[model samples]
Target: MAEGISSDYAVIELWKAVKSIKKDAQDVSVIEGNIPKVAEMVMEYILKNINYFVPINNNLVRPKTYPIDNDPMSVNWLFVLHTLNFSLWYPKGTKQWKVDGKKGYFGLCNAIRRAIEDGKPIWNPEYYTKMTKSELECILQSDDGEPEIPLIDERLRILHEVGEVLLQKYKGTFMECLKLSEYDADKLMKLLSMNSSHIGTK
Candidate 1:
């Protein structure tokens, strides 16, 4: 970023370059191959140079979620990893943790909202990549140590708690609705037989 330039401008310029190249590239794999180079540029301009104002958690404005390191590959490789992870959620067989919680940030946002709205019970833990609180703290804790990878278990636990809080508010009503909607074919058949006096006597 320039001394006086804004993050929005920096991101726009970066995306223009990234998209132009991506438009002609064969596949995301090719983009993946070049990620390190893009990552280097992002580091140089955004992470290392860091002068502009960057915001987090703003709902009113469009989020420009470039990595804090400004590593374009942070954004790039992230997309590839997230897409692959989410695809694993709908399983063909056993839903091992590998794909069970593989939702992107938006997906997690929706899941949390649904859990809250539907009065669903505790959120089932899945991997929350960006919201890895422990990992973030570990990164802060280190001065020279390698950045700590997040504990997937702890992350899931947090989601479960959050889900529980949301669901508790409406759990009774939601469960009642669930029970009422459940089918009882035999009981329905018995009632129908008893009420069929005028039905097809011929």
Candidate 2:
């Protein structure tokens, strides 16, 4: 079994924390009257789209533009993707960084795909641990005249930090971490939160 608190208790603790904060929260308040309406709306929508909610559905799969596959490397690829997923929102009126005409998150996805196509082993901790700013620039380069990806330096630092952790603690592959979590999603989340500074538990 995974160590530390159980996932059920973790959720209960989170609920308690949120409730405590909500009591004193001035800027935000949950309207209890809207709960049933919201729940009904959600249920109606889900029921209306029940066909898409099946176990075998591929509608929720990642886009084809992403550099992922049915392999352990995809886990590390996702790790890298989410590590740099933040700070994508840019101020209005500014030129957005794009890859293959896709902006923001999809742009980042395409950039990773493009990098992999160019023979860059971006999913490998060994490769990313030594990745330099210039290399990342090339990987995430935008269309001509477009602005560079935001927070490149911070993203690079996070990548280096996570890559080192993967190498030193998780055998350079996220698969090992997954194994340690026994394929439990909650355990995996806690493991990532405990191990990586960039990924914290809410």
Best by TM-score: 2
Question: Scored by CA lDDT, what does every candidate get?
Answer: 0.36, 0.79
For candidate 1, write residues 114-133 as lDDT tens digits. 43345432222122223355
Clashing pairs in 1: none
TM-score of 1: 0.22
Each prediction's TM-score versus the true structure? 0.22, 0.71
* Residue 41 lDDT in candidate 1: 88
Clashing pairs in model 2? none
lDDT of 2 by residue, 83-152 (tens): 8887664554556678898776778888998998899999998998899999998999998745888889
